[model samples]
Target: MVLHDALSEDHVEELAQLLALIRRGSAVTRSELVQSSGFGRTAIARRLDHLMALGLIAESEPLPSTGGRMPRGVYFRADAGRLLVAELGATSIAAGICDLDCRVLSSREEAWDIAAGPESTLARLEALLSELLRDHQAKVWGIGVGLPGPIEFATGRPVSPPIMPGWDRYPVRERLAKRFSAPVWVDNDVNVLALGELRAGVGRAHSDLIYIKIGTGIGAGIVSGGRLHRGAQGCAGDIGHVAVTDDQAVVCRCGNIGCLEAVAGGAALARRATAWAREGRSGYLQQRLTEGGDLTAATIAAGAAAGDTGCVELLAAAARQIGDSLATFVNFFNPSIVIIGGGVAQAGNAFLASIRQRVYSRSLPLATRDLQIVLSSLGDIGGLIGAAHMVVDEILSPKVLSLWIKEGTPEALAGAHAGN
Candidate 1:
């Protein structure tokens, strides 16, 4: 099939749909495309040929013959381009280069504080990405970033992030775009984690689920009907600031009283443990403080593991608080699965058991009956994988594809999408 210089809207849509089908492994053969897309054999052939001509997809080995001729398998050409992805946490950064399918090819992770401000933080991210991209030969098609704060999705700017000081209204996408010359997409870190789970982790089996990240702070990412629900102002899952208690003494970093983060977040657990250690409540914690000079959520977990009643009580209390907050969401959203992740969640099975127990006890019977509460399967790499998927999803969408398919590359579309 000869490729046309100018594609009609219908042609573009069909081509995008066909490519998406193959990319997702939903329709890997010409016959499957016809059945799935309601397009004739000839139309599917033309679109597949066009995609191959553009180096976006390729024909693979023939499938087993059902009756007569064997069918050739079609698949997205993942090596056709590369995607740069970075998942920034409150105190660390994970950056990687991924193929078109969002599989990480190479990655680097290190401790880095978000409080270092946008300039410093992004510079480190760019440096790390550059290092990872240094040896790869594939052309970078786009960039995806996950930040530990609320991001204005349209502009890819930080929106008064409580933990990310000096990042308010920062032009994240524009800066990264200028540095890398690629279209950039930014989202909340938790949202990217949820995306990672949906694409490559435990949530892959369920379309409706919630991912809760408990680290320096707490937040959630909601997926409904296989779509991420960011809600109005792109802060739908900002459950950290929801008042979980009426205790005026408990203050959150966001200046909110009795916020869930103040009661059940990593910092809160660490604070309580440290105070207990200083007050001689736990001999293990006190010894740990004497040796390390400070305590953290990990210290509390360790103490609990060592059979310290104080640490056990502290973790249980925090877990119950988190579970109570999660119960409300479970009752309202009724997700099929709830994924617990982040640094604090690494406290092991006991912490997860406590959370599961509380959630099941507090939630509605119908909602809890079928819900599965589990820990993150991807661990620290979930954000990186999720960020990669974010870029791939956006760049391959029909609307964005229509803008760049004619050019055979997204280079020109980069500036337009980056708000340059």
Candidate 2:
């Protein structure tokens, strides 16, 4: 029998409630736990002791009471172990270490250019992981990688991604597992960003949200009822390939024409900026660009910030186009929130204001009420933490929990405690 199935239904329900309470802020008293979890006192105590014996939870002495009997409490240890998050992007690879609360403890970045393909990227990731693990004494719980394309969750392989060439069948999970000797998970980078936003960033206060990432490429990740929807083929959020225009003029990376990404990706924006600059059509981007310095999302963000009318106009247009694409989503999903992230989102309020105006004005009025259009609060850290959350989810699973028990990693204890 699976370790998860070993627990009774009542035990599972109590455990789920315990995790939710601990995740909110671990310092729950027994009385409060009973109220929040709706479990009998004996049952809660029994489960707590089981988790404690697993080295997953520890109890604290009674607290000072205002006018009543002091109650003993339990709390999750934030630094019991470590979670590693590596974000693999088209232009750079960023890695971060997060504790139980999902706060970034340490992070580092290196540019290797995703165009270099899987081997070079994997090598860079290994180097970064070594450097990060070398300085810390904590045992790692799991490793989560955020890749540039839709992924197969079971195998951790990208499947026929448009922009990411030569990576369609990359064995990311197996390769990472061999290096780390721990469970590893790979997911679409934007999906991880959406997860980050949903749990710790802008989408925290709202469920039924859509997270759109506009960067080197365009994609969306959807969360409904606080759960990610990856679809049957893990391509539920592959909005970049949606045929927005019927022109058939420019070919997309997927061999399709008039796809949204082909028309509005960062490469498209950079090419337009370069042409305008060459023609002396705008001095704004010219002033922002340094000799031999590549045009980047930061440069574009800086251009818009510097009051470059052309850059601002281009951003607004991109926002309108994105908004147009999202209108269809609004009609279908009617989400309560929409979060925009990725390099381009660094444009901040200027970009957010435009997208908000377009989405609200163009979409249906009934759907617009209580709808939130916001930028990612996680900033560049979204991908990393989202990756970590993926590992955490698996670690929280019953079968994985049993494996974690056998491994005796400190993070497994922390997770079990959160469940209790």
Best by TM-score: 1
RMSD, every candidate, angstroms: 1.4, 4.3
For candidate 1, list the clashing residue pairs, or say none. none
Could you tell me how far off, in angstroms, the CA of residue 90 lies in candidate 2 after the best superposition? 0.7
Model 2, CA-based lDDT: 0.77
Could you give me the TM-score of model 2 versus the true structure? 0.90
Candidate 1: tens digits of C-alpha lDDT, residues 1-420: 356646888888888888888988998988889999999998787788889888999889989886899989998899999999999999899999999888999999999999999888999999999998997977889999999899988889889999998999999888888888889999999999999999999999999999999999999999999989998899889999999889989999999899999988998988888889899999988898889766888888888898999999899999999998999999999999999998889888899999999999999999998899999999999999999999888888888888888788876677776676
Alpha-carbon local distance difference test for all models: 0.90, 0.77
Model 1 stretches with alpha carbons more than 4 Å out: 1-6
Residues forming the 10-long window of minimal summed lDDT in candidate 1? 1-10
Residues 146-249 of candidate 2 have per-residue lDDT tens digits of 88888987778999866677788888777776666566778888888899888878888887999998888898999988888888988888898888888866
How high is each candidate's TM-score?
0.97, 0.90
